[model samples]
Target: MAELSEQTGVAQSTIRSLIRGRLKRLDSISTGKLAQFFQCKLDELYVMKWE
Candidate 1:
């Protein structure tokens, strides 16, 4: 999570919320940035359950 935040330059809280499926909405620019950071599909980030 910290790596994601650092890579995307997004706050840890925001990343945590997204990962937890608790974020109500996402900013397009931030989403694109995260997608790049993870090197995965944008939708893959929001897993419904914790792993």
Candidate 2:
């Protein structure tokens, strides 16, 4: 996670929040960074569930 955060320029706290399902939202820039680091499309970063 630390390595990912460093490589992606995202804070560890944000990544931790995401992993813990405590993140209410993800900004486009952060999402893009993560997607780029993971070599995936932006849409692939998260799932949409019908509530």
What lDDT does the true structure give each of the candidates? Answer: 0.76, 0.78
Ten consecutive residues with minimal summed lDDT in candidate 1? 42-51
Tens-place lDDT per residue, model 2, 1-51, is 999999999999998887666775779899888878979864454553212
- Model 2: colliding residue pairs: none
For model 1, how does the per-residue alpha-carbon lDDT over 1-51 read when each residue is reduced to its tens digit?
A: 778788788889988887667885779888788878878766765553443
| Top-scoring candidate (lDDT) | 2
lDDT of 1 at 50: 44
Looking at candidate 2, the ten consecutive residues that score lowest on lDDT are: 42-51
